[model samples]
Target: MPLLDASRDLIAAAARRVMARCDELARVSAAQSGIERVYLSPEHARVNRLAAEWMREVGMTTRQDAAGNQLGRVGDPASAALMLGSHLDTVPDAGRYDGIVGVLMALEVVRLLRDATLPFAIEVVAFSDEEGTRFGKALLGSSAVAGAWDPGWWSLTDAEGTSLREAFLEFGLDPGRIGEAARQPDELVGYLEAHIEQGPELDERGESLAVVSSIASARRFQLIVEGEARHAGGTPYDRRRDALLGASEAALAVERICRAEHHIIGTVGQLEAYPGAVNVVPGEARLSLDLRGEFDGARDSVWSAISAELDAIMGRRGLRWTAREVHSAPAVFCAPLLQDAVREGIRSTVATTEDPAVIFSRAGHDGMAIGAVTGVGMLFLRNPDGISHHPDESVSEGDVARGIQSLAETVLQLAADR
Candidate 1:
């Protein structure tokens, strides 16, 4: 593979452009996701238009699907396409690089490819609603493309009771036409995404690149523990069935289970106690648990352990309880051929032994969603501190350049395949 000077310049320019728009985009994302105090707001339509314009500026033809996904095409429509891009939406108050990096890199790829002749078409996508912060549904755009959209999904409402369908209408997107976003199996020959590691794996190990093997299996659930409400001053410790205590016990069980299992992570991210007043005895508690493991059986074992612990705690405390499974996605392995290509891409970049390749990723990405339908590969640029999704997230300019080099090489190599 030959390195092109113009491609390097284009990638550098794209990164600079992204950095300049960081503050403005962050504010827009925060407001649209209604992330100040909630999960996310339905602002896919708003961001899609902005992304379309950016795509056009880079010489790519753009379009918005009914699912609110935006695609910018480079190369000929008749050729097999290699799609590169990421989601545009952010987590509530999320730092800029979470999803934006991949999207920008895709645009950069288009800009670079347009300057040269390529065998395959390249479609840069800005997928909508991958965070599930707004509609409680993750991977909305990718799911549509994968033919996984459920009619009932559009009927789901946000915390404020705004239906997703209505939100689409407000954005001038026809929810009824969402099915049109589905791609023919042959349309996408391969996919590549450049994303921040969003975890300590790369930084902690002093590795600059991560060729991901698989995405972790995740199970999300809500536990509701109910107990009698009483005045704090009037209730005796031994006589009261404290829901908070049971909830605490359950949380600890979750921690212990995760600690006992390798490559498994469990978090009780959200917890609410009724009568949160200091003087009142809590009557109800709601907690959300997110358990993940690299293997399916490991995840199931951890869930079982957690459930047993929750049951024992509830029984011992004499508290009524309920548990509901909210979402579960089995671990997904990246296609081996694509993985090998990514590895080759990494090796193609000249680097010191200090910048060796590593393989691990704890954070979920749009690539995981796309992998379900098509071959997908990812590249992780080094983050010295492994910090991401925050304002302080940083990556060296050199690493960015190397990553783009690797990406362009990989795309060119893949495009050469008949």
Candidate 2:
């Protein structure tokens, strides 16, 4: 748990490199107007080339894996590799930090230690896709590495109706060779990811960085309410069975119930009312519910309550309702020793009266999938105003410096353990 032995100058240099690289990658967007580097897109290839070039400059051997993941390795291939880096993919108009920062930070870590190779190997992985923006399934890159790639995903299509397999082929990668991306059990020491906090927690606590305890379990649901579509002017309020109105009540109940609980979040991210007509009442209303929590029990408990509330709401309005499960993922906890290494890394970078803050992420990460294969650890850098997935999302140079140092120190810390 002792502070990282690296000098301040090295940390500063690494920070500068990460900041410059982030700006450089921001320009390679799929959209000319804003950032939109989705999976298997041309922009994705452009960014990977840039990242791979930087990795090579830092004295690492680089390759673009079959899954389109850009990987850079330091030390002998025979050695057990400590996997570092984050996803390179982004949501449309995403902030410069989110996943890209982590990839750059990992490459910087290798650069900081260029003079002395660690006892084991270090690999920086620019995961091809984690946002799921194009294919609507997140962690596609990490899933392949974790040996969890679903063959069903091959048929998944983008907004343009192009299949995932077709996109892979067009991107100069063989979809049939995706299995080649999976890392064997003996190939890794562990996985470490350094990323922007994407929330106000660290900033609110007046800290630049913190260790993550767990990634939240999440569930997505589609709720639909059905009612008779009648003439709006003729159907009196008292006699009307309005599907939209019933759906609105259910949404409000979701917010109220979640707000009353601790660590549980429920959001209706999308909503639609059917039967397109200015005068006719909506015959059906459909809404998307995304619920997440630190624990599966808490998440499911809140979901069941929401479902019951929906039942009551529909019953009162004489509307028929149904709930469909869309997506579900269980929580992933950080390994205890990895948590200690990151905590010590934080300790090495800043002055803290209390213990270094540890947070449970409500937002998901590629770590969730990677954790299925090996131990995983995460370090979170502070983000101003907790903004992400937007052009205005920002992070400070000073925070980046601290984050780089913390991540480098974490590698050393874990190295000592082995």
Candidate 3:
């Protein structure tokens, strides 16, 4: 397939539109200072409405799915769709781009292809939840779309003690009908997402975009260490059984073990000691572990090594330890056909004779869930310094412009392949 006519001015104008829309959505935060829009919140509803309105302006029909995902589509309603988009949800104190840019870029792609003919329809989705900041579970929206929603998630509560079911009701949705959100494999040709690279790989290589090879396999756990509370002033080091000490040792062991393995990463993001009193030794300590790897066996093996180290630490500290598995997902690899499409799409925009860069995403994405039902592909725009999940995360307008063209071309490439 020949490339689309992506003139410099047209790309510049589209990039500005995408950037301005991003700024507008960033204001729909739950916080007063930084951006934060969680699932089933007022902000989510507002953004969905806004996205729907934009979709309508592009002559596409829109709907808010039972799972609260915002969707828009153009072309024949009966045809299988080429789905494009990313999450609309954000983490606490989030950057403007992470998921938002992808949604906007999807819209731009639809706009660019408005005059082109294709075999399948185009659908843009703004997934309601991917960060899982409120529900503590990622990919809820996409999982529902992939027919993988867990019934037990309804009981999961937020920090304010609002259950997921309750939040759904409050957001004007019926929990019983959530199954309506699932899309059969026959209904979709494939899924493609254009997102800001959450890491520095592209920026480090001085490239504008890259084709995503695969998303990492991940597991999360809540760990607890138990011990007897004692007086801080009178308890001797030999007599004290400190839960905090045991948990601390476990965290260090996680870092050491993960660092020794290739492409495995472990983080101890949350930690707390019970009784939180300066005058008393902690009776219990709780911490969270997020482990990810390029492969499932490697990720699981590292967890086993960490578990053995935790056993040794607890034994030495005279404490007891336990772990609760909260979440797990296997690695999702991109289809070779989609990967080639993405590569050619990216190569079309660059001036280089070399092939465009290819990368494996270490972070989680909705593709992890959608991959269950159909082929999945991703195009990543550069993120300076690899910063994300924070306010400082950034992408240049030029990169976004190229990303918009690249994604449009990718769709054409897919259409030609079909």
Candidate 4:
């Protein structure tokens, strides 16, 4: 893609608009202080309406899909579309930019080329359930679009004990009609998403943007450790079998094993011990393990090592251990065509002599599901310190400005490719 004639001032103004819009959406959250917007909730409805209004402003037609994903399109509606945008749902206490920035930046891309003739139509989607904060199932919205929705998901309930089927009805949607949201493979030319880096790669490299090579393969498990409970005061150190202690050691083992490997990550996010009395040794303990890697083989290898270490720890403590797999997804690699488009897009906006940076995302995104139906590519903006999923997560206005231009350029590149 050739360098765009768009002036610095034009890009700056658009970036400011994106920032302001993010702040506006941040207020539409469930939490009293922090940000928390889940699927099929009132906040989801409000944000969808707001996105729809913005879509209309950009001369695009808008609608809410049967799966409750917000969508907008411009150009020839009868033709296949090159989809842009990302999820609108967020993790608990999520920062403002994680997914919200991508949706808004996509709108800006549309605004930049609303009048330009294209080979295909362009569509923006604000996926309703990417975080899985409510239903414990990620990519529900995108999975529906990919025609990969599982009937089993209907029975999944939220913390409030409301089933997904019930939530759909409450949100004025019919669960049976969700098939309407799925797009045939030919109906989409490709999907491109712009999002914050959600890591420190770009910021540390002093670059504003980079092309994502792939999203990490992931495996999540609930690990349980069991040991006999005994009187805390009466039991000797060698005689006591403490489940909590064994579970703690297992968590540390996960970190140790993963740390020794390249591009592997392990997190023990949640832990709980049974038998609440302080005087009593815990009889049972459970913990959540989130393991990710760039490749499935390496990821599985790390899991084996961690499991072996767990067995040794448990055996030494006279305990038993087991793990129940909760979720697993193979890595999704970006299509060569889309990746080239994004690479050229970033090159057009930068003055550096080096080629644009490329990274494999350790974090997951809607693309993981959308990739099943069509080619997918991503551009990531610099996130300061990569402090995501927290209130302090941040992105600079300057980076946002670069991101808008890069994305707009990427659309042009793809259009040229077609």
Q: Local error of candidate 4 at 71, Å?
A: 0.3
Worst 10 residues of 3 by lDDT: 1-10
Per-residue CA lDDT of candidate 3, range 226-277, in tens?
Answer: 9989999999999999889889889999999999999999999999998899
TM-score of each: 0.93, 0.96, 0.99, 0.98
Give the per-residue lDDT digits (tens) of candidate 1, residues 1-418. 4544454566677667656554445556445453221222344555666788888998888888878788988778798788998887876656667777778777766776677777778899988777787777777878888888889787889877889888778777788788899887688888888887877777786667768888778888989999988999998998788888889889988998899889999999898999798988889999999888889898899888888888888999989889898777778787787787777777766455443465656777776677767887888877767776556676766666677777777777675554
When summed lDDT is taken over every stretch of 10 residues in candidate 4, the lowest stretch is 1-10
**What's the lDDT for all of these models?**
0.77, 0.89, 0.94, 0.93
**Is 1 or 4 the stronger prediction by TM-score?**
4
lDDT of 4 at 325: 93
Candidate 4 backbone collisions, by pair:
none
Off by over 4 Å in 2: 1-6
Error of 3 at 4 (Å): 0.5
Question: Higher lDDT: candidate 3 or 4?
Answer: 3
> TM-score-based ranking, best first?
3, 4, 2, 1
lDDT of 4: 0.93
lDDT of 2 by residue, 1-418 (tens): 4445677787787788888888888888888888889999988988888888988998999999889999999998789999999988889878888898999989888887766657889999999889889998888999999988899999999999999999999999998899999987789889999988878898898878889999999998888899989999998998888889898898899999999989999999778888958898989999989999999999999988988888888899999999888678899999999999999888977776678889988889989999988899999988888888899888888899888888888998888777
